[model samples]
Structures are given as C-alpha cells and as structure tokens.
Target: MKWSMRIVMTLTISLVIAVCLSLLPKMDSSIGINSPYHWPSNRIGQVTDNNLPDLLVQVPLQMRIRKVELSSTRMSLDLSLPKNADSTSVYRDLYTIAQTMLMKTKNVNQVWVRVIDYSGVSDNASTQLVLAMVAERESGKDMDKSASELSLIQLEQELQNRFRITYTSKWQQRYPL
Candidate 1:
C-alpha cells in the first residue's frame, strides 16, 4: 500500500508539472510579456493608414528625388535638380506632381517641396536641404492601389533612375510627422 501511494504521488506531481509548463506561454501572452507567438521584427504588418513612406517610394518622378516623407495629412519631397535644369521650373513641376498625387486621396491635405542645389558645394560641404511639412489629420478613407506590384528588375531600374544621389549622402529630417 505504501509503494502504491508513492507511485500515485509521483504521477500526480508529474502531471502537475506538465500542466504548468504548458500554461506558461499562454500566461506570458495574456500578461503582455515576451511570447513565442508574437510577430518578429522583420515581419511586415497589415498595410494600414500609416504606410505613407511606402507609397511615396512608388511615385514616378522625372528628376532625381532624394527623399520623401509622408503622413496622414501631409507630404514632403527632397529633390536634387540637375545643374542644367531651371530650379524654379523644377520646383513648380515637382510641387504640382506631389500635390496632385497626394491630394487625390481624402487623407492628405497639403504637400511641400524642397529643391536642393548641389552645384558649387565642395566635396566635404553639406548639401542637405531643410524643409518641414505638417498637416492636421482628417477622418477619411484610405487610397486604393489597383495596379499590380512591380517586378524586381523594374524596381531596380526605377531606383537607379530616380535616386542619383549615393546612399551615403546625408538627408535632412524635414517632416514633422
């Protein structure tokens, strides 16, 4: 009888330990601690109302666009105009393009443009442009993308053509949002 009691106690203790180990992960998730089921840092979330930067990179441009920043209500662009191009005309064209592209959706209210002139600056001199674009958030529906995704080759070509500036160049933090 004592041997039987000892066997029964050992089984109960093992079962209790197994149940507790199984419940540990669930308890961690419920309490908002580090959980195994949580999303990894590299995993992209759903395309929500905050994916303006992704959209900006897809916009077609004639000149070399350095940087783009967008928010729920405002958008900004930094462009490096060619030495031969007219700065005023380039600015007007870029501003119009940005305004039209962004204002088509009800979410954006304003667009800002900054033209960076890298004509005579020394190799060590800074050529970063400073500009800010800010707008109040509006309650509106998101924009729809009916077009299919571009191929890797097409994307690479677009990047090579659009971004003439090197990746090591410094860019100003212009957008407030």
Candidate 2:
C-alpha cells in the first residue's frame, strides 16, 4: 500500500508540472500586450482610426534615410596639428544641427545619425568631417511601395539641397558600404 501511494504521488507531481508549463506561454502572451517587443500581429496592415494618426505616409519595406554632418575650418600650414585630432566637438555640433532640420521633415517617420570621421582639410583653408545615420523604412502589407520610394527619395534630395557644403576631407565610421 505504501509503494502504491509513492507512485501515485510521483505521477501527480509530474502532471502538475506539465500543466504549469503549458500555461506559461498563455500568460506570457497576455503580459506582452504592453511590452516593447515587436510581435507578428494579425492586424499588421489593418487600417483603423487609431492607426491612422500614427501613419506617416505608408513607409516602404526598404526605404533608407541617411544623416550627414559637415565640419570645416581653415588653418595655416605652419600650425602642425597632432596626428589624432579630437574632433568630437565639431561632429556633435553638426549632428545637432542636422537632427533639428530632419525632425521637421515630412513622410519620414524616424531619423538616426552619427559622425563618421574628419574628412580632412584642403589648401582652400577648410577642414571638414561628416556624420550620418541610415534609417530603414517600416513597411507593411498595406503599404504602397511607390509612395514609400518617393518619400525616401524626397528626403534624400532635401538633405542634399539644404546642406550640400563641400568638405575638404571627410571621415566617416558608419556609411552604406
């Protein structure tokens, strides 16, 4: 009789563990509603009044936005600078300026940017560096590819037109290699 009881206890414990494990995923799904993890939602492309406000013009699947910063200065050849010149300050200034301008752009949902490196100075009394960020487009099944392409192209053109200052020598760490 004692042996039978022990066997029954083991089976009961195993069943309990199995039941708990099965419930874990359902609990996780419930808790994930407010989580930041992007999940595959059945309504990924569903249009609704709430999502309408968030829509920034049907982003494409592969749209890219690049951030560019320029730094330029003039120095005499006699002024010998160190081989590793710290140009962090120059890059920071350019990044701030470019970010501000990009925030005002339309159709682009997000913009990311960073400084690459100092391009270098030329005989024309100018030392310049560049910073940039490439943002990918968030695409959905309901999104229009053509519209997304146009938006990306327009954003690129706008940046070029507005901040097309020539750089003597530019160095960048992150580029679309």
TM-score of each: 0.36, 0.35
Residue-level lDDT tens digits of model 2 in 110-145 = 334443332354453463334344332331112222
Residue 32 Cα positional deviation in candidate 1, in Å, after optimal superposition: 32
Candidate 1, residues 41-153, lDDT tens digits: the string is: 33322222344444444545556767667665555666775656542344334433443444344455555556665656786266754322222223111222211244434
**Residue 101 shift from truth in candidate 1, angstroms:** 3.2
Q: After superposition, how far is residue 115 of candidate 1 from its true place, in Å?
A: 0.4
TM-score of 2: 0.35
> In model 2, which regions exceed 4 Å deviation?
36-112, 115-128, 132-148, 151-153, 160-177
For every candidate in turn, the CA RMSD to the true structure comes to 12.3, 14.2
Candidates' lDDT values, in order? 0.47, 0.37
Q: Candidate 2: deviation at residue 71, Å?
A: 24
The CA root-mean-square deviation of candidate 1, after full C-alpha superposition on the true structure, stands at 12.3
Candidate 1's C-alpha runs over 4 A off are 1-60, 87-92, 120-125, 128-177
Worst ten-residue run, lDDT, model 2? 70-79
